[model samples]
Target: MSDVVYTTTHRVVVPFYVYAGLAFLVATGMLFTGAAEFSGHYFQPHILAITHTMALGWGTMIILGASHQLLPVLMEGELYSVKLAYLSYTFTGIGIALLVWAFYIFHMGWPAKCGALLINAGVIAFFVNVVMSIVKSKKENIQAIFMLTAAGWLAFTTLAGGLLICNFTENILPDGSLHYLSLHAHIGIVGWFLLLVMGVGSRLIPMFLISKYDSPKILWSIYGLINGGLITFIFIFLREAVSVLYMIPVLCVTGGIVLFGFFCRKAYRQRIRRQVDEEMKISLLAVVMMVLPLVFLIAVIVTLMTISADVHMVLAYGFTIFFGWLTAIILGMTFKTLPFIIWNRVYHARAGTGATPVPKELFSSRLFNIMAVCFIIGFISFVAGIVISNGIAMKVGALLLLLCAFLYNANVFKLLFHKDRML
Candidate 1:
């Protein structure tokens, strides 16, 4: 019932946006250069570089920063240490830069190993900080548990990735290194990213809607379904089990998504604030996007059993999960969360004095709409290009996506530098 917003220091959050912006620029350039072509396989050097850029540089970076700010709010307590937060960011930024460079050049040398080590340490620091905060907090919530579990998965992901890197040098996994890549990717995507989103989104969506709705039971069910699915997946995946057994985790994750969709519907129905703003509307669109990867996964599984798994379908599935679902949610939530943080920093003290610009007034909605349209077009075109093997369509889609990234950065800058005016 309180409108209080808890956040970490600006130093912790702002640097993350800077890294995300740089990552977006790099990804757009990769797309423009055709390094991102579908090419019927997921494990080329350039593609790996691009994926790391988006995953580590943009997605994980933002999540790391935002979680520092959001966890205190979720836990109803202060961060364990501000200094640790800064250290985590520094190590992660350096690690990402080095790793990306190594991948770009197709070299897995000492530099890559060092980068992997640094990243692992950084993640460990972050995990420790979050755990400490959770332990110290008096208020307990399911959202906090979601975050802790996600952090644990992230640690597992990094450890697996480090082994993957080692495989290049030592040839540790003689069976075939590529086979383990799916485990690494899924742990990061579904275990870390999807679970974290569900945890955070469950709380934020209702709050933003001004809905007093609270369903602890529904949230617990979703948590159980996702983690249960993931645990089962790890067991099946490790044994190199039968193909059909894979469907079990897929079904569990699908159930979690369906339950989450129902939860969103209930929140919307209960919302006191009608006429949802453009920002929240975009966020809601991400909820729809969540279903897309499920559809793609079903196609992938069907093809796997019947026709030996089409490469294009597999690529489509990854594309939908990363770009369509994860990116959309991050894009939407960035606007919703960042503006309030900036507005509080700039105008909170001046609030009862004559007049002040509301948080919504900090940026241009027209620009947001343009970015949204471009993103949808680009996503659809890019997926179609992959489906049909059309290079030209892919190029066009990449260009549009590049434009969307530029517009997004521009708007972020606008909010960061908004000047106050007296009314």
Candidate 2:
């Protein structure tokens, strides 16, 4: 299949992009305000707020939006229900606002509960939409299956998150929140975000590079390893096994990551398009960004093996995954995807009639470059601050990130409100 998907509605898709851009801005601002929180435990109220904003508002929302558009393309069919997609956005947007507010205030009450419930409903709606779309198409692609499984995991993640919030007041979990927190976080991180990335990235990176590499068998194996590792983790957590056993799942997932890297490498080596652009380069760097989390995870593992697990090390791991890997990929892919979507919207009916602005004209490369610089500096500074327990570094990093967020939002709006101009 070609890399163009025009099935989803502009109204449905654009709001998600707008919301996610605003979310990144809000999340970075929150991190700036709460930079002091990084010096302490990772479970602080503000920290929780920032995490959800990054995860739900910025990352998951974009994925949901993009998937709605891409799913039909993957299956070579139209989306089963655009109305359900709209439903998802409404419920999810409300849930995220309510939940973020509740967490910031540390209010683990009805608002939080209701927020969680609403998010759960939203994810369920999305999953139903996905399943029906895929079923109706009656076509199976490993890439689409990856999306399907990720949706299922997303449902579980929201459900688990709700239970965790409920456990703040009620005694629902047998083990404490900390023990369950690892399981909950990993399910969303690896299962939902990472799995989806690997799947979608596998298809997109190669396609954009104009590579002839396509291996369904290897893709299936990678899928199994990731899911197998996650399922094993759930089982071990349920059994309350020793900490060392967690390594089993870790190793399995790590193996999958390695294979994915190799897959991307092969695609790059065999690419037909030799002149890679800045955006493609940034997306490629996300492959390296994945290592940031793996390094921190190993540190956490070694610490657990030798001494007590350092909370700061754990914080670094989570931040690297969200900000480092996920954010980099999103920033890069946003340019790649959003431009085309907007260009199509503007020029689909006017194609070949006259001179027209290409997709890249919808946004500013200069703005994106400045944003990338801020992301690099800010991400490094904040991570270093967490390591050395320095508040100033964290603040500077967050401040830069805030600037980065502004630039991102600026570029996003530029594209969203783009006008037709022939050169």
Best by TM-score: 2
Question: Clash pairs of candidate 1?
Answer: none
Candidate 1 regions with alpha-carbon error over 4 angstroms: 1-5
What's the CA error at residue 416 for candidate 1, in Å?
1.4
lDDT of 1 by residue, 1-423 (tens): 556656687778888887887787788678668634575587777777878888888888889988998999998778998888888888888998888888889889987888888889888989999999999988889999999999999999988898898888898886566889888998998889999999999999999999888889988999999999999999998997877898999999888988898998999999999979877887888989988887777787788777677788787888787668778887888898888878878887797775888788898888988998888899889888888888888888888888888888888899889877666
Backbone clash numbers for all candidates listed: 0, 0
Which 10-residue span in candidate 2 carries the lowest summed lDDT?
1-10
Q: What is residue 243's positional error in candidate 2, in angstroms?
A: 1.4
Give the best candidate by lDDT: 2
Kindly list the per-residue Cα lDDT of model 2 for residues 1-423, writing each as its tens digit: 555543787788889989999999999999998899999999888999999999999999999999987888888888989899999999998999999999999898998999999999889989999999999986779999999999999999999999999998997988666668988999999899999999999999998899999888889989999999999989988897877888998899988989899999999999998999878888999988888898889789778877788999999999998889899999999999999889888888888776788787789999999999999999999999999999999999999999999999999998988888866
